[model samples]
Structure formats: C-alpha cells, structure tokens
Target: MINSTQVSYFILVAYFDTGALKYLYFMIVMSLYMLIVGANLLLIVVICLNRSLHEPMYLFLCSLFVNELYGSTGLFPFLLLQILSDIHTVSAPFCYLQIFCVHFYGSVQFFTLGVMSYDRYLAICHPLQYHIRMTSSKVAILTAFIWLYSVLATVVMMSLSVPLQRCGNTIEKVYCDNYSIVKLACSDTTVSNIFGLVYIFTVIFGLVILILYTYMRILKVCFSGSKQTRQKAVSTCTPHLASLLSFAFGSFFEIVQGRFNMSRVPIMFRIFLSLYWLTCQPLFTPVLYGLNMSKIRIISKILYLGRRM
Candidate 1:
C-alpha cells in the first residue's frame, strides 16, 4: 500500500465511463460554470462601479458575489476538466489544494451569511442606527474578517491533513474533502479528527445560532412595527431567507453524505447530492438575489440593455 508521501496522485473512484455522453456532460457543466461566473461577476461589477450601491447591504452582497466566484472557480474548472478526461486522478498536492478551496468556500459562506443576517437585523430592527453601526469601515472590517477567519481555519485544517501518512490514495467522490483524506491516513488521526469536529461545530453551529437569533429579532420587530416597516422587512429579508434555506438544503445533504453510509442511495443521486452545494448554491444565490433585489435587478437590466450611464 502506498502511503501519502509515495502517493503522488489520488484516484477519484466516483467517475465512471460516460462514453459519448462525456461531451454532453462537459458542455452542460461548462455552460453552467459560465453562467455562474457571468451572473456573479456582473453583480460584483455592478456593486463596485455604481456609487448608488455603496451601502452596507450592497457591500455585503458584493463580498458574497466575489465569494461565489471564488468557490465556483475552484470547483467548476476542475470539474470540467475531469468530465472530459478519461482519468479522474488528481495530483496529491492538487487534491489538498482543492480540499482547502472547497472548505474555505464553505467556511466563508456560513460566516458571510451570518454577517448578512446581522446586517438585515440592523436594517430592520434598528433602522434608525443601521448606518451608524454598519459604517463603511465596519463593513470593510467585517468583510476582511470573513475571508481572513476562513483562511486561518482552512489553513489549520490543511496543515494537520498534509502531514498525515495515507494508507490509500483513493477518494470515493468526484472531489477531495478533508474528511475523505483523513480516512486514508496510515498515521494516527485522533488529533486531526478531534480538531475537525471542533472546527466544524465552532463554525457551523455557532454561525447557525447567530443567523437564527438575528432573524428571530428581526421578525419580532416586523411584527410590532408599522406596516411600512413590515413591508421593508419582507422585501429586504425575503432573498436572505431564501438564500439561507437553499444553502441549508445543500448543507444538510453534504453533512449526511460525509458522516453516514450512503451506499443504498442511487449513485447518480448521491453524485448530485455531493455537487448540490458546490454547483447549485453558487448558481442559485446570484440568480435569487439578482431577481429579488429590485435595485440590483434594475441595474442588471440596464447593463444588459447597454443603457448609457
């Protein structure tokens, strides 16, 4: 058995022979990737270029769109290449890097969403002081914290994982995950596994609580406040609620897949489950936000129509 040092590459066992359909799959994936990039990038550019969109909410959204690009770029390009290639093997170093990017994407997603929730809470619950609390500098600091925190966490996870001695080099999924890599280790992983659980709970559950609490408070205000306030809350918070639900769906399946034995599930379905968040969330968020947020929708329409500035 080849240990990690000797294992130059990892065989992705999930990919099967699609024969003539490989091209079809490639085309489908490539199109989705392009659409994701275009949609997210459009919103990012719109937010950055237009002075009207320089508010706290739009700024948070800009950070989000940028992350969608970051996450999708990490997965989609590698996926497109794998779809077309006969061999689904990834270099060991590349596998670790993919692990980092995918994890980093998720970490940032949850953290950003948590912050977005707080932003909404401020807007709805304390509209009078929303600007006072979420000043431009504060938004910049929060945005920086989101990325920086995710980086430090991902880096720590990667550092622990990279030194492990692998007993095998086969990963059962189309992509590499830290857990899957840990399962292959020939060395002791007690410390790694423990840290992994702590890391996951600290990030996931903690942020989940924050999101839940923020929305709860926001809801309380909407109920007791004026009609206009209720309308404002609904219009502003609907997209965020949808986004959280969408991500929760993907995240649930991901957790189930990662922690449980899922051989009874259909292979195609399982594959879809794995790809749900990485593919669907990235594609879903921009579309959801773009269509739902009127200001963004109008600007996007204007840009698409080539209207004069």
Candidate 2:
C-alpha cells in the first residue's frame, strides 16, 4: 500500500487547459485576491486605529477581517500559481498544511459569527447588562478560545488523516481538501469520517441554529418595543443576517462539491462554484459591516476622506 510518505505529490484534477486565456484568468484572480486583501486590511486597520471602534462589535469585526485575510491568503497565492502553471500538482506536506488552514479558517468563521450574534443579542435584548457581560477582557478571552479550539480540533483531525495509508494522490479540486485526502487513504477512514460529521454538526449547524435563535429573540423584543428599538435591530442585525445567509449559500455549495458527484456539470462552472465559497463572503462582510454600519462609515470617511468623527 502506498502510504502518505510514498505519495509525495497530489494532482489537482479540477484545472483544465485554458490556453492563452490563462493570462486573463490570472489577472482576474490576482485582482480578486488583491481586493480581498485590501478590503479586509482596510477594515482591520480602521477598527484597530479608531478609539471609538474599541467596542465589542467592532473588535469582533476585526477578528473576522483578519480571518478572511488568513483564509484567502492560504488559498489564493497558490491558486494563482497553479492557474498559470501547466502542471497543477501540490506537495503532500503543503497540501496538508493548506488543509489545516482552510479548515481552521472555516471553523473560526462559523464560531466568530456565532459569537457576534450572541453579542448582538445581548446588545439589543439586554442592553443594560451587555457591557458588563461582554467586557473587553471577556471578548479577548472568547476570541482566544475561538482560535485555540479551532487549532486543537483541526490538529486532531489532521493527525488522523496525514498518516493513513494513501492509495492515491489525485484530489479533484482547485485546492486541498481534508475529505479528499482521507478518501485517498488505502487504510480505514472511519474515524476521520465520524469526526468530520461531528465537527460539521457541532460547528456549522450548531452556529446556524445559534444565529437563528438569537435573531428570533431580537425579533420578539422589537415587535413589542418602540420604533427606535425596531430600527436599531434592523440597522444592527441586517448585515449580520445578510452575512450569515450569503455565507451559508456559498458554504452549501462547497459541502456539496466535496461530498456529492457533479461529474456531468461543466468544469468551468464547477471551478467557479468551488471558488465562490471563499470569495463572496470575504467581499460581502467588509462591505456590509463597513458601509452599512453608520459608525464604521463615519470613521472610515474620517480616515479615508480627511473628515472628523
């Protein structure tokens, strides 16, 4: 049996010949990558530099932006190189590393969003106690927990996959996927499969439920409250809901891409769908939170347009 040590490289089967169009593809992807980096960085800096934005919500946003940059950076540079190269293969070690990063990013994204929802619920539903409950130190502790938990869980999952007896080195995607790697293992992958399912249910589905439940509570408060309360909920929760839905849509397709057969679909469309999961949400979050939230907008204007807050 060919184990992971024997399998030095993995062929990414998603890429097809684009010939001269590769230059066009390269420019497009490079531009997208740059934009993701620029937008996320701008927001991160705005959140960091402004004393007014030192609140819990903005702090959480900074974490979100940083995670976006992390996730995209993990994928895009290598993706750009792969697009231009005639060969679309990655080393086994780097592939596993990419797997770690992508999974960590995803888990953290779900978690941070969940925490942000809880923050909002406190802000709107229990305004008086919000500050006391979610103090700066608490936010720091929570943020640390999110990153640490994701790392420890992902490390355990990777340990299971990396040493397995690999029977193949072909991953039919534009990037490394842990499930794909596990599928290549000649040895049993029952443990990995169970852990993956448990992780998804607890992290992905659990967060979705949390977000939904928090919104439900907020909505109930708004219905009986004054116009100002309703408006506040709309202003604050709209972006969060929009973010959750957009990311969910993208994530659904990604899960499908990994688990289901789509061989009949056109290759180009499949590739775009795969990349969409990582691209759309990163762009959406900065725009939604940065522009849609008035405080961020005012502060961003001050920094970028030389206005005073």
Model 2, 91-184: lDDT tens digits are 9889999999988988888889899999999999999999999999999999999999999998999998899998889998999988899888
Q: What ranges in model 2 sit over 4 Å off? A: 307-309
Measured on C-alpha atoms, candidate 2 has an lDDT of 0.90
Stretches of candidate 1 above 4 Å error? 307-309
The pairs that clash in candidate 1 are none
Predicted candidate 1 versus true structure: per-residue lDDT over 99-193, tens digit per residue: 99999998888888889999999888887998999999999999999999899999998888888988888888999988888888889888888
Clashes of each: 0, 0
lDDT of each: 0.89, 0.90
- Lowest summed-lDDT stretch of 10 residues in model 1? 300-309
Q: Model 2 clash pairs?
A: none
Q: What lDDT is reached at residue 105 by model 1?
A: 93
The top-ranked prediction according to lDDT is 2
